[model samples]
Target: MNIKRIEDTLNEFNKIGYSRHGMNRLAFTKEEEKVKRVLIELCEKEGMEARIDHCGNVIMIKEGKNPNLAPVIIGSHLDTVYNGGQYDGSVGVGVGVEIICSINDRNIQPERRVELICFVGEEASRFGMGTIGSSAMAGKFDQEVMSRLTDQEGVSFPKAVENVELDFETIRLASREGERIHAFFEVHIEQGPVLENHQKKIGVVTAIAAPTRLKVTIVGKASHSGTTPMNYRKDALLGASEIALTVEEAAKLEAVNGTVATVGQCSVFPGAMNVVPGRAEMKIDIRGTNVESKQVVVLKLLECFKDLKNRRHLDIQYEYLVDKAPVKLDTKMINSLSTTCEELGVPHLQMVSGAGHDAMNMASICPTGLLFIPCKEGLSHHKNEFASIEDIAIGAQVLEHEILKSM
Candidate 1:
């Protein structure tokens, strides 16, 4: 590994964004555009052809001895959550470029072309659409959904991109044409304490969990708090409260296959100290390593609601906001990553990712593997999230080695 090159490469983009607290390069914003231009400049400086697609994803290609073969693609997103850490997505983009530069410096002719991609809209901060770039590349993005989405400022997805001077129709068309990625590789922080807790240096991801986000509403009659009798009144807040507890109980069941359910948001209509709430809403999030297990938990929650609606005489309704499914990465890619870690004397652990990533969408188009390097204290999506240069350097070597083996 060329330590000087890697450090200089990361430094080029590390200072791209700044905030009162820390970094804030949310997708489609002006700050992120600056980062994209820097990416193009660095990639072109290394003799790689850089192109930005309709979805605003930056793809840089280094021609191989056989330029026609399906390229081995290594990438991560450039966008970040509001006030996010620098290393979350930026590390992979920087290290990926370093890998190509290192190969070029060594005068090694790779068997296939290699692409370093910087996906946009990976964070839910802007549009709540994770993997916007990769999903478009995989031809799985839903225009209807995008049309209906709005940001916190009430900006629609199409409007958000338009504000950034991007054409929505072009982005939709770009997504329809999925790229031919022979294999996809992404290096990201573990965002968990597993690696550091076990004293491991690397993590070969086994699977990435997908979350189902839903909004549940309960309706009942609002009545005078002091005059309403407990048995005579149908309390919406009470029903919602009971359902929330039931959601927890359902996920805790042993038969549910380790599914985790959370009702993290709740609201009561007529939110007052003396008012008996007439309506209540709760946001539900359920996730598991497999889609079936997640569906099972959802079914269980609905059943519990059915019994409550029947017995408590309340109206229950719920709508699915997101239903992303868990994905199993390519076994061959996982093995290749593990084998390389061992060959290079890098300490690694095999684990499941509890968060969503662009790699999850790439799996729809080709075999994809996510490499995890420990973040200090397992923190991510914040200013304090960090990965040591030493761990990152090891991950880059493992990535380059794995790419070579596949070629």
Candidate 2:
């Protein structure tokens, strides 16, 4: 692998939306467009046919010797959450570009074509939904979902698509037939401390945990903080806080099942310090690989919400923002990855990903594999999120081997 070229490519991308806080390449933003343009230019130089599909995914194809065989698809998203780390999504794309570079340098023409896809809107930061590109490719995205989704700034999903110069009217064209893809693979940072703690260089993902996101609203009467007695006052923020703890406790009970829950976002009404909060909104994300175990936690949470509503005398209502079941990757591909790691003498662990990825959606269409490289302290989605170039190169080597092997 060309380590210098890989590092340079990643560094160039890191500059697009960079700030002291973190990367700001949120979906449908100008920074994301700039980065996509850079990728397209690079792919064009390598003699690959590149285009942005109606769903806004950048598909770059390097034709091989045989047109009969389906293409081997690899790559990840280019978008990031608000103040997210640079390496989270971009590393996979950089490594993919390097893979193409190596293939060209060796002048080896595989039987199957290679497609590197930089999917758009993989982060849910903007629309409260993610995997937009891959979902469309898997035939899961539609006009209804697009029209319903709105960003925090009140930008509808269709408007976001238009802002990026993509037409929503022809989005159906983005739906790819499953038989057209032979296999799919993605490399990403572990986003957790698992690999680093285990002293493993790579993680061959067995399955990806699906996220069930909820938007909760707690309503209570607002009153003067100083005048209202503690017994008489109704505070929505306090109720929300209790529910958050309940979420934590519920998740803890299911920790053995690898289930976890988080209340990542919370907003309280009434900005004045002198007045009690009249309402609070929270965004809850629960995930697990085991379906039944995850449902247990969800049921427990709903029960807790009811208890809180009755005891606190507050009106609590919640809407399901996202509720997707976990996805298991292809077993044949899993063994292939393990064998490749063994041949390469790379230390790898077979594990399940707690975080959601585009691979989860692709699994429905074709055999998909996800590889995880370690990040410092398992930190991701932050300014300091980092995965070494050497580690990424190692991942690229493995990815290249898999692509060639599949061919």
What is the Cα-based lDDT of residue 363 in candidate 1? Answer: 83
Cα RMSD of predicted structure 1: 2.1
For candidate 2, the TM-score is: 0.91
- Model 2, residue 197: distance off in Å is 1.1
Candidate 1, superposed: residue stretches over 4 Å from native: 3-8, 175-180, 254-256
lDDT of 2 by residue, 105-210 (tens): 9888879999999988899898877888888888888788688889998988888888988888887688885567899999999999999999999999999998
lDDT of 1 by residue, 144-220 (tens): 88889898888889988888777887776666245566899999989989999999999999899888989999998
> After superposing candidate 2, which stretches have Cα over 4 Å from the reference?
220-238, 269-279
User: Which candidate has the top score in TM-score?
Assistant: 1
Report lDDT (CA) for all predictions.
Answer: 0.86, 0.90
The predictions' CA RMSDs to the true structure, in order, are 2.1, 2.3
Q: Which ten residues in a row have the lowest lDDT in candidate 1?
A: 172-181
Error of 1 at 173 (Å): 3.6
